[model samples]
Target: MPLSAALLQTLHSIVGDKGFTTNQGEIAPYLQESRNRFQGHCDILIRPKNTQEVAEVLAICNDENIPVVPQGGNTGHCGGAVPQGGILLNLSRLNKIRQLDGLNATITVDAGCILQNVQLTADKADLYFPLSLAAEGSCQIGGNLATNAGGIHVLRYGNMRDLTLGLEVVLPDGQIWDGLRALRKDNTGYDLKHLFIGSEGTLGVITGAVLKLFPKPKARACAFVASESPGHLMDVFAYMRDYFGEQLCAFEMMPRFGLDLVLKHITGTTDPFAIAYQWYGVLEISTSRPNTNLQTELEEALHPLFDRGYIQNAVVAQDLMQAEKIWALRESMSEAQKREGGSVKHDISVPVSHIPDFLAETSHAVCNVVPGSRICAFGHVGDGNIHFNISQPETMEKAAFLTNWEALNEIVHEMAEKYEGSFSAEHGVGQLKINEMDRFRGGVELDSMRLIKRAFDPNNIMNPGKVVKI
Candidate 1:
């Protein structure tokens, strides 16, 4: 259904001429997320300033039976931020750090605040906000929470859902529900905030949030180690857990192809090792306690593995700069791959023990399905999440390579399912994975999800045709 003139006038009047724009040129950038797979179209773009304004805009849209797609930094890979049609609600102006309670170790912020800016603000107050990702500089808190983002720090602080305490949302009917209580333990009947955390805006539009903070780490040690296989990495994780315990901050895995791409594409990025290894794992240990000897503990734990031939080589960062340099090589992987060619990326997770089997089996299956495809699998090994991405064969045309994406996804997902792994891990099921969700997610789970969707957004106006199909 098309939006009526009266409703457009109401939306325009609420946001003012400066905020409302129907210009395709102006709205072009917001149509697609970082992945560039799912593109959106909108009747008009709405930029509401505050919670009240957001609620009013939503209310008017709701009355007119218009769908509303809430967009933040537009940096999402899952296509959750892209609008289907109707109104595109831009939350960039809602950027405000409402409060920073140092005593309680909590910070309340608007949905539009860029993730890196949030980290910086927390750092200024001598605290740590542990949700660090490559898109932190551009991705907004609302998008992060919407996707329940799991980044480099999931080994320590956990995902966006765990880090968040409360959320302020504008419901389908334009009513505001303020659950912004900064409580660590709340014995409430139902934890409603969890509903919107990773709903991908299907439930409601997240406007503001109260997030947990941590004491800043005083010391850190990082290393890039060569693992014989994913199993060897698991063994290393056990060793780190047995020794460093809570200090083991991150454990990331990298396939040989992923590392090679980064070193080849990104100038100045070098391989930490002289010889190419089948698998590599980057582990970091951080401590808030001053004078903690984390580096010594890491070396001690690796001594046995080094002797046993489980790990081929290892280089521990001696200083902060060196640590960042080593991390830069790992972090540049995705961007470097993008520069190289079209990539079919999957953010999937399996059990820690099954990671080895999943990797080996999925690699074999995907390559067999699409021969010459390069498997560049890597991600947070601590949480068992693998960014199992497939790179186009160097000889193949971009269009021809991308034509096999769905087939490649099938091969990867089949093996993942065999390991009892998720089809979509960190990235939410936006428009891109709706079909995957229909196939993979069970009837009971889908029914429950639909029930919640119906409860909050019965009219199907809030991010319609996303997460689940009605």
Candidate 2:
């Protein structure tokens, strides 16, 4: 149903003419997600300037029983931000850095602040905010916390949930829950901030956040390693973890096919070795203490792996430029896959020990289902998260190959369950994996989620048709 003129008039009064737009041309960008998998329509796109304005908008929407979709950056892999109807609430205008407490090592900022701007803010203070991702340039901090984003540095720093100290959210009923306490330990009650951290905007609008920061690393080292197989790479990872301890910042794995894709499509990237190997690993170690000679230590660590034949070859980057070149190959995996053809992507995780068997078995299963499919698997091996993507065969049509998306996902997700793993690892369950929630999640676990959804959003006005369905 279209929003009534009276309700629209009231909403317009709360946020002036600049905050609301009904023009389709101005609203076109917010209607589609990055993947183009989900396209949405909205009666109006409201950009609230502050928390009070957001509360007022939500209060009116709730009173009218209108569906509201809160969008942040719109960079999510899942379709969480895509609106089904009613109003689309975008938090882009609420961009502000509220505070920076050096003594407490926390920085407070509004939801719409771009992620890269936050990182740069911390850098200027000689502190670090480690929630880094490829979309940091445009992705908002609210979206990062909403999705509980994980990136390369998760091996050392942890995800957005761990990095967050507190949040300022406007509840579904227009009540502002100012739980933005920047403390190291707060045992006052149930950690309410946690409830909204990974909720994907179903509960409330995350207006502001207080996040933890760390001392910037002064010493760094990087290496590109080659191994015969995934098993050997795992062995190398385990050894590095034990050797480097907390200094091991990132340990990423890449298959030979994935590297070839990057070299072929992405310019200025050359293979790190003279001869290609079956599998590869990118290792990074850093310390906040200056002049730590991490490169020499990393070089010494590789000698033992070569002796055990776990690594066929290795190259330790001697300078900052060389290290960045090595990391670029790992970062370019996803874009390169797109250049090939249609890709059926899966973000999955299992026990770090089970990755080798999981890959071997899942690869066989996928090929059997779609013969000639190219399996391009790579991700954070240290954290056990693998992006298992399948490219269509050269002879097959892209649309025809994508028709197997559901079948292929079922096969891979079933395998992940067999190994006692999660179907949605870091990517939150938006509209894409709602069915998987019904399939893999059930009993008290799922029931409790639905109960919380009903309790928090009784009107079902907050991000309707997302996360949990009541």
Candidate 3:
């Protein structure tokens, strides 16, 4: 059904003329996600300035039965931000750091604040907001909260879910749920804020949040080492944790192919060591106090493995710029692969013990299904989350490569089930993964999700046809 002129006029009035745009050229950018894989067509794009404006927009849309898609920086890998022929309610204009309570170690920020900005704000106060990602420069805090984003820090700080103390949300029917209390121990009830954190805009729109902060690290060191397998990496991880439990900040894994793609496409990059091994592990250690030698700590912890040949070679970054150079190689994997060809990406997780089996089996299955396919599997190895991505064979056509998406996804997702892993790890189940969810999610689980959707959004006016397809 087409929206009435009066309803569109009301929405335009709430956000003002400058805030609304119907031009296809202007709306086209906001309609698609980062990967350019999922595209949506929206009738209007509304840039709301504050929580009250967001509530007003939702109120009008809800009354008129007009669906609304809440979007942030629009850097999501999943189609979580794409609209479904409705209004694209962008929160970028709502960029504001409401408060920074140094005593409490909490920062209250508006949804649209860039994630890196938030981190920088905390850094100025001798604090840290440990949600580090490759897209932090472009992604927003609301999107991070929406997807419950996990990055390299999950090994020590956990994901976005653990970093967030509370949230302020605009509900489906235009009511505000002010659950933004920054108390550490509030086991008061059902923990409703969590439901909206990873809900992906199905239940409501996130307006603001109170995020947790940590002490800034004074000593830090990064190392690139070669491990024989996940098992050997696991042993190394266990050894490090025994001595530097919380200090071991990040543990990332990269297959040889992933490293090759990075070296091939990204300039100013080189091998960290003299020898190129089949598998590589990037590890970092940090401490909040000064006068600590992280390099010495890592060297001591890894001496046994170094002697036993479990690790082939290692390079420790001498300075901050060198540390960043080492990390740049890891961060450029996705884009480097994109330069090669189309990619099929799966963000999944398995038991810490079963990562090797999952990788070996899934690699074998995908290769058998599509011969000559290049696999670039790399991600946070500490939490067992692997971004299992495959590039089309160099000789194949892009159109023909996408045709095998379903077959490849089936093989990988089935193995995820066998290992008792999640098909959708940090990336939520947007429209792109609904069919996969239907295959994996139990009937009762789906029914309960539906019940909640019906309870919160009876008319289904909030991002309709996303995340379980209400």
Backbone clash pairs for candidate 1 read none
RMSD to native, candidate 3: 1.2
Error of 2 at 7 (Å): 1.4
Give all TM-scores, in the order shown. Answer: 0.97, 0.99, 0.98
lDDT of 2 at 15: 90
Residue lDDT tens for model 2, 7-79: 8888999999988988889998998978789999987999999999999999888888988899999999889
Which order, best to worst by lDDT? 2, 3, 1
Cα lDDT, model 2, residue 117: 95
The lDDT of each candidate is: 0.88, 0.93, 0.88
Which sections of candidate 1 miss by over 4 Å?
Answer: none
Query: lDDT score of model 1?
Result: 0.88
Q: Give the Å shift of residue 354 in candidate 1.
A: 0.2
- Candidate 1 versus the native: TM-score? 0.97
Instruction: Indicate which candidate wins on TM-score.
Output: 2
Tens-digit per-residue lDDT, 313-394, candidate 3: 7888888998998898899999999998887999999987888889988999999999988888888878989899999998
- Tell me which of candidates 2 and 3 scores higher on TM-score: 2
Displacement of the residue 243 alpha carbon in candidate 1, Å: 1.4
